[model samples]
Target: MQLAVLGSPIGQALSPVLHRAAFQALGLDWTYHAIDCTPDRLASFLGELDDTWAGLSLTMPLKQSVVPLLDRASDTVVRTGAANTIVVSDGQLIGENTDLYGMTQALSDAGVTTACGVTVLGAGATACTALAAAHELGCDRATVIARNAGRARQFLGPAAERIGVKVRITPWTTAPAHLEAELVISALPPGAADELAPLWKPAAGTLMDVLYRPWPTPLAQAAATAGRRVIGGLPMLVHQAARQVELQTKCPRPPYEDMLTAASAAVHQLDTTT
Candidate 1:
């Protein structure tokens, strides 16, 4: 069977490597690749797939765009209006969000089982998932720090409401003040929060930045120096892709450790100390 991860700038995606490793570990001959796909081309691209395709992992703009094209959407996808994993069942497309699961699992693996206070940085699609993940981790409310609070409220409000999680919109400039929350999830793009690194002095919070390629992001590094728990995005990426592998192949356990090892090796090529 075949699988792929789709996004506009997909060259940096580790989904192919992660999922391919999962396939190998499960002893299944599968092909997974990265496809540069924009929102405009998603529908047609999904339409052109043959029966040989099993599933797909999505990144960035494609996550929300692919929701409308799905024959069925999981509850998380329906609530957040985003689907990062798609399962091809009997030629039907079923949308599922392993990102929320991956985030919760990542936090759990880092010894954070629950968070009373949670703060999310940036209000993009990933931020939506972060909010839901925070809720899953026992957080009833979350603070969304975005460059534009208005845009953040507009995009993230309904999702929060549907998830029954209250969210407060705050300007991104105030991000440094909210780092003391039980959990701080940085949903900003790679390098978007680099300038904030100098100002980051997290107070007793676990920092989870959702950018793995350039591991130990500037903000995360600063938090770690302060003796705070810091988690890179690789764990979440591996767990999410592992769930994708399970959904695609029907295997109960998809060898997540293998996936992590593969992803770590791939990122090590660029940054050795991940």
Candidate 2:
């Protein structure tokens, strides 16, 4: 069996590491790879593939673009208006969103029992998933801070409306001061987090960064230094990949320790390559 994570500039993806580890631990002869697929090339790529492709992990530009190309999608995919995982059965592609699963799992693992006010940075695809996660956690009020305020609203406004959560969009510079919340989720890219680090005050709540590649992100480090609980994005990646493996192979749960070891090794290899 074969599977792959498809995205543009996918060199940094850890999917292969986790999936391969799970397959190896389970003694399955499955292969997982990453394809650097741009949006313009997606259709031709999908058309070229046959039933040999067991599943696919979509990221970035492909997530929203591939939704219309899928034969069908789960309710979660429809609601999120994005596709992260696709399973092919009988030559038909079915789309699902494991991003939400990842976000929710990360929050739960951090012991965020009840959703309080949330300030989320970035309003891209990942931010949409974060909003969905916040709603699932019962967060009624949310403030979305984005470089492009309109884009942030475009990304999160509909989902917030559907989920009955009050969401407001604001420029990152004008984000409210003296903010109080039980949880703060940073969806910004790695470098962006560094700039936002100073603006971040040490709230007595959990601070979660969706970027895990660099390990302790600047925001996470600041939060840690301030004695705040922080959750890295690696746990979310692992848990979400576990759900994807279960969906694809009906495995109980991906062997997390093995997956983590493989992922850590992959990260080290990535560091060396860079």
Candidate 3:
């Protein structure tokens, strides 16, 4: 079987390593690759896939873009309006948003069981997943910090209402006072939150930065220096990809530890090379 991760600038993705490790451990002769696909050309790309294609792991611009093209979507995808995992079963496409579980499991692994006040950085599709994860972790209210207040509110307001999390949208230029929360999930890209990192003065709790390629992101470093519990995105990536493996291969249980080891090694290698 064949599987792949689809996104622009997808060369840096560790998904192939993780999934290949899972297949090796499970004795499955499957191949996975990374493909550069954008929103405009996604339809053409999907049309070219043959029966050997088992699944596609989406990232960045393709997550929301692939939603309308799927035959069916999961509740998480419907709730977040994003699809990260597409399984091809009997030539039918099924979309699922495993990112909800991904973020929540990453938080739980970092010693966060439940949270009250939450602050999420940015207001993109990943931010939506963060909000859903926070709600699942018992966060009743949240404050989203973004640059475009209008766009942020327009996208997050209804999502907050749907998820039952009272949300307060704050502009990035404003002070970072609203950042004081039990948990802060940074959905922004690397170096995007550097300005707020030094100014962040949260009294306590964890900060899970959803970026692992660069090792200690500026935001993550600042949070750690401030004595906050810090966790990277690798844990979440591993868990979500493991779920995708199960969904694609019909494996009741994939080799999670093997994937984790492979992902850790890949990240370590990247850190060393950089």
RMSD of each: 1.8, 1.7, 1.3
Candidate 2 vs 3: which has more lDDT: 3
Candidate 3 Cα misplacement greater than 4 A, ranges: none
Q: Write the per-residue lDDT of candidate 2 for residues 40-92, one digit (tens) a residue.
A: 99989888778788889998879889989999998888777888998888898
Q: Write the per-residue lDDT of candidate 1 for residues 186-234, one digit (tens) a residue.
A: 9998889988787756367789998886767888888898767998898
Q: How close is candidate 3 to the true structure, as a TM-score?
A: 0.96
Q: Assess each prediction's global lDDT (C-alpha) against the native.
A: 0.88, 0.82, 0.88
Cα displacement (angstroms), candidate 2, residue 56, comes to: 0.2
Tell me the tens digit of each residue's lDDT in model 3 across 1-274.
8999999989889999999999999999999999999999999888888899999999989998899999899988888888999999888899999888888878888789898888889999999999898889888888899878899998888878777788888998763776567788999987788888778784677889998878788888888887789989989999899899989999999898999999999888888887
Looking at model 2, report the run of 10 residues with the lowest lDDT sum: 174-183
Q: How many residue pairs clash in each candidate?
A: 0, 0, 0
TM-score of each: 0.96, 0.94, 0.96
As a TM-score, model 2 comes out at 0.94
Residue 243 of model 1: what lDDT? 82
